[model samples]
Target chain A: MIHQTSLMAIAIFLFFASTVIGISFYLGRKAKSASGYFAAGGGIHWAVNGVAFAGDYLSAASFLGICGMIAFFGYDGFLYSIGYLAGWIVALFIIAEPLKRMGRFTFADALDSKFNSRGIKLAAAISTLVVSCFYLIPQMVGAGALVQPLLGFPHYVGVIIVGLIVTLIVTTAGMVSTTWVQFIKGGLLVILCTIITIMLLVRGISTAPTDANGKASYIAKRGVTTVELQSMGTVVEPDGAWIGKKDPVTGDMKPAPYVRIKNAAGVVSVWRKDVVKFKDGNPDVTTFSETQATYTVNGKKNVNGLPRGKGEGEADLKPVGYLSKLPNGEKETGSQTPWGFLSTMQKSEAILWANEKIKDAAGVETTVYYQKPTLGSDFMTPGSSPTFKKVREEKFFGKLDFLSLMLALFCGTASLPHILIRYYTVKDQASARKSTVVGIGVIGLFYVLTLFLGLGAMTSGALDVSDSNMSAPLLARSMSEFLFAVISAVAFTTVLGTVSGLIMAASGAVAHDLASNVFKFKLDDFQKVKVAKMAAVCVGILAIGLGILFSKMNVNFLVGWAFNIAASANLPALVMLLFWKRTTKQGITAAITVGMISSLAWILLSAQAYKDVYGWDPATAIVPFSQPAIVTIPLGFLVLVLVSLFTPKPKDLAAVEKAS
Target chain B: MAGLDFKGSGEREKEDAGVVAHNTKLGVWLFLVYVLVYGGFIALAAFRPDVMKQPLILGINVAVVYGFTLIVSALAIALVYMKTCRK
Candidate 1:
């Protein structure tokens, strides 16, 4: 299945990639100067630019993460969609025209427009590069991830393919091709996803997901002690790194680093074997003597404790957290009201709502849990995007989570440099304003639909609780193969469109500012094109490498980090440049630099990084969490204020007149 | 709205406010209208969380019932523009 889909996905994507490359080439002939390439000579239609905003903004994280989240976590995923769309309110009212009126080609162009400080140029350029790259990594990872099931190729292949295709698209024409590509993709994705959702509602849940034997195309598996995990014809590590062979067939040479897990239970065991093409290649099934087992297996209990073996959301299968046959010591009447079950959880002192399991160094486990959310609705609780993360999940959360989520969405939208530069492509400030509204309309509708889609997936019995990213495509598969193919392809294109825009932004920053402004490398218009293309190639390669390395992280979680960085680093500087009359070169420069550096520093030292990357006993990070907007937004404003006060106004006052 | 940028800065300066800036003023109002629509929902959540539990006119809560009121405001703004545009 993986190989066939992977090949088909690759073939279609290549065809799409080539067609875009052709468009870029055709557009390039008309592009003469830096402005032509960077801003499409400021001549794109407003409607097209608006749709392009959807394309650029809806990254792999949006499609994969939201859908998967909805499938697994329910209403939590839909909340993300609301938060994301709410942000454009800021974009439409606050920053739209001011942005178009202020800048020439790039996001940095707007920030550096008021004061031609090399420092502002340097800082804004670095921030753009950093944010773009952070955003790019998730798309790259999604690229690799999507290729595995669709094209049947490895994740690395998918990453390389996207990197190459995006590089070709950007180098060919720059903003013109990128904009049109986004417009086409954005329009198609929203329409098609809506169509898919309608179909799902028409065909409601069934006991047999696809076939009657209760067999799923995908299922989760626990530890594999008896069976060997091999890669490249050799015994492999968890990461698929090749180790020396193990003769599990022979009793002698067992696989190195392989653990032994024994379970003694009368119940039948179901193991999801990749059967290849998935993690740990399928669990190698072996019958062992019951004596070595650590778990005594206190009978059978499902995630929600009902029947032993069946897909979730099946009619015969009980709803999760509602017991047909309760666990030992658990009591419930079948006739209980919904509110009774939920309200009891709210009052219970036993922590269930916000539970954390912590293990000390001596190998003792201590659990600290909250008991508020009883998973009554299951549709409206934590565990994914489009939903409020900390606030909706737990009670008594400080307003910090509420503010952080809103602030991330609000500032993240405008601060995204890819979304910003779209304004420069339109003819004027009015077009910028019009396009933003159009984008709001399109993006808003799609976000509302995500709730239905997420609900449909949850009920469809395709929600992989461990991995939410697979929710949408897997949900599509539950309905039909054709829908799965279409959804997967659109999801693939989602990554492609976003990564292309990001790479273009990064390339522009490197070529336009770092080369021309920082090093003072004087390149003619034609030479500038060449330099930008080279820069695209370099950034593309970097994104490809990072994407594969960080493939394990959820796309939306990574995207949240991107939002925090973009909001903290870029937003305050841009807002100050437009609104504040006293905004000096030093202020803009220092704000961008300090905001970027401090946020980046906080993320690296975060608890998430310690757990996921460092694999060490988690350290207490300086910031309350990795998200920096709560701290960094105010800091950027302060830096701008203090620096502007001390520094002299630039000799060039023309920027103030023209910018307005 | 589409080709306004082609007009020279001098042409723009010479032109009267003549419903263009009137529309611009309308735009400012419409933008504020949008803010109210979204902000109103949050306010309802904060101040009248219980109102969401009760039906307003229909079986829907006051929050759910008024959710479309915000979008309707956006439509009202859109319609106002359409009414005044050059035929």
Candidate 2:
């Protein structure tokens, strides 16, 4: 797809970036001490910290990935919404208040509060770094995805820009500026999405969506075309129409949905074939269809015969995602209530895009994107996408994968280091609980609006079939260029807010837990803050590299893996430390070590990593299932229990009993 | 300057151990209730997806209705916990 560099988008993006950096500089004066830098001096208001929670929590995965998933797969995307919100219950009810009472700088502080063991510190700190890096991948990938269309830059360049800016933000002021940045962007993301959803409802669903230029954004046609069979193992059609091929083995005629054609200019292209039946009995007529694009990859570069940008002869990708048939054969629904919107979509038929890679006998590869007309019932169901389609399969392991993912998402939110540290930004346990309640309300509202945003994009006629992560921003562009610019800028800030928070968490772990506590460093608070700043820069660079490396995977799916690791590694140790009386430092350390390694090893050996990351056959993966939380979480709990039972009681148990 | 003041009024009222215990008890109960509801949603989606496809209320299918309910219920449960738990 050809993307034009928009002056408006670039201008708004600069404005947002400058304002964030300006806030960092302004707040930098107060964050000189370690407390100020790491925990915002525990001074952030409950409400502001609450919105920052939304900002920190709603990374690129929630906005871009979930919206893109819904646009592509329908109701399956909403599953992430539900699972994410559900995880907050664990935060509010179980982790928030107790965690606030225990932790000072990082998740390690809370875990080591009881035993004060260096072993627990080392285990928790490593887990924090591992989970933060895991979470950072999706945010960075999202940063790259936004840059492609918004700034008209390459994916790696976008990742680098965000990496540098976020590193600056973290190095300058730490959590104080990070909190405010998150607060502002969090508010903007929710408000802007609400506005888009309102416009979507006002505009309503249409069978034929039009671009801002009033051109029909989707292509759907049927007409008979002549085809001439060639003798030299090739098929020819005068108008580049799709033609059937004779099977080499059976010598029988077979319909080919996509046929390779060499045009009069000798440029090879692929055309789609559609067999249409009319009421007048048109003798099984065939018509030619326009394919989305014929993508060619030579080494690392993608070259399309079509134009790249908006030059004089440049052409953009055809806007897709239109309803093939509206309810009751109406061309459009003028306006809709929220429920009316769902009910209307229930009875409609949508034209969803699916792709297939074809290699001709000459070994020339072409990717053909075709439209499938799906019933609204099936569209709104859970199994529309390949990721979640396993839920509908008969195999138990298929369903187990879906169950494990939901479990991970539910448990992972409370265990994330970045989120856990936010509790310290507030003053006391009460503020922690209150801020979490506020976060739940704000985040829940945003997730609800995602359904509309995703469904709106699904029929917006502005989707790039090749990139699903651009769905929301592209949906905004379909409405107006100005909204698109604002949304894209806000989306960039969303990444900025989340990445800075993750960096803060990682740096805190490095300087405080590893350097100060475990290694018994004699550094003062000032020196510790300096070390943390240095650590922030290093982690930021690492995140940028991983972001570029894992560019092809969907952002939300990567987040799911992060959640699995966080839940497996951290949740067991943290929960047992709080609730169980027999929990020893040895047990906590063992649980953290075992959980982290088991989940990491499981993911590396899983089919998903083999196929997407390693480019190896998925069947060669040793793990029976992709998600590890279902097995690994239980393993963590059991390991903690057995280890604690065998280890001696804490040496401080008597002093603690006397004090109580 | 006000935002920089690390020690705020929120620190003045620390809950006693009794209050903390009571809140923990209340929170655990609420957490269990949400777990059951969330587990049911996951089970249906994974095992009984046919049930999820069937419409339960207002012409919307069970999957969407249940999914929306989970989100709204989380907010509702949080609000209840905030009101009832002694913080």
Best-matching candidate per TM-score: 2
Model 1 C-alpha lDDT per residue in residues A1-660, reported as the tens digit of each score: 112353454556666667767776777676667777777778788888889999998888888888766555554565567667766766765666667766776877777766666888888899999999889988998888887867677889889888888887788778888886787789878997888766755553332233223454221122333443221123212221112234646746433222222223222222222212346777545422111011112553232112434455311221111111122334432332323322322222120112233233344332221112233223333322323444433344433555565567667888888888888888766677678778877776677667657655654544443345776776666666666776777787788789889988888888888899888999998888789889999998898889888978767777888888888888888777766778888888888888888877877777667766677545555456655677888898899899998988655565555665
lDDT for model 2 comes to: 0.86
Worst 10 residues of 1 chain A by lDDT: A287-296
- What is the C-alpha lDDT profile of model 1 across B1-87, one tens digit per residue? 123111112111122335444544555566577666766665444344455444454332344335434434444555464455321
Off by over 4 Å in 2: A222-256, A262-269, A272-289, A297-316, A651-654, A657-660, B1-13
Candidate 2, chain B, TM-score (2 decimals): 0.84
The C-alpha stretches of model 1 lying farther than 4 A from their native spots are: A1-11, A205-378, A381-399, A649-660, B1-87
Q: If scored against the real structure, what TM-score would every candidate get?
A: 0.74, 0.93
| CAPRI rating of model 1 | incorrect
lDDT of 2 by residue, A1-660 (tens): 666678898899899999989888878877898989998878788999899999999998899889999998899998999989899999999999888887788989888877778999999999999999989999999899889878989999999999999999999999988988899899999999999999989988888888766777866443425353121124444222133456767998766676555555444444566777788877777656556556555542232345444565444556688888887889989988999999888888888888876555555555677777789899798888988898899999778888889899999999999999999998888789999999999999999999999999999999888888889988898889899989989998899999999999999999999999999999998999999999999999999999999888767768888899999999998888878988998999999999999999999999999998889989889999999999999999999999999999776666863664
lDDT of each: 0.63, 0.86
TM-score (chain A only) of candidate 2:
0.92
Candidate 2 per-residue lDDT, tens place, B8-83, comes to 3323345588999999999999999999999899888888888988877878999899999999899898889889
Report the lDDT of model 2 for residue A33.
86
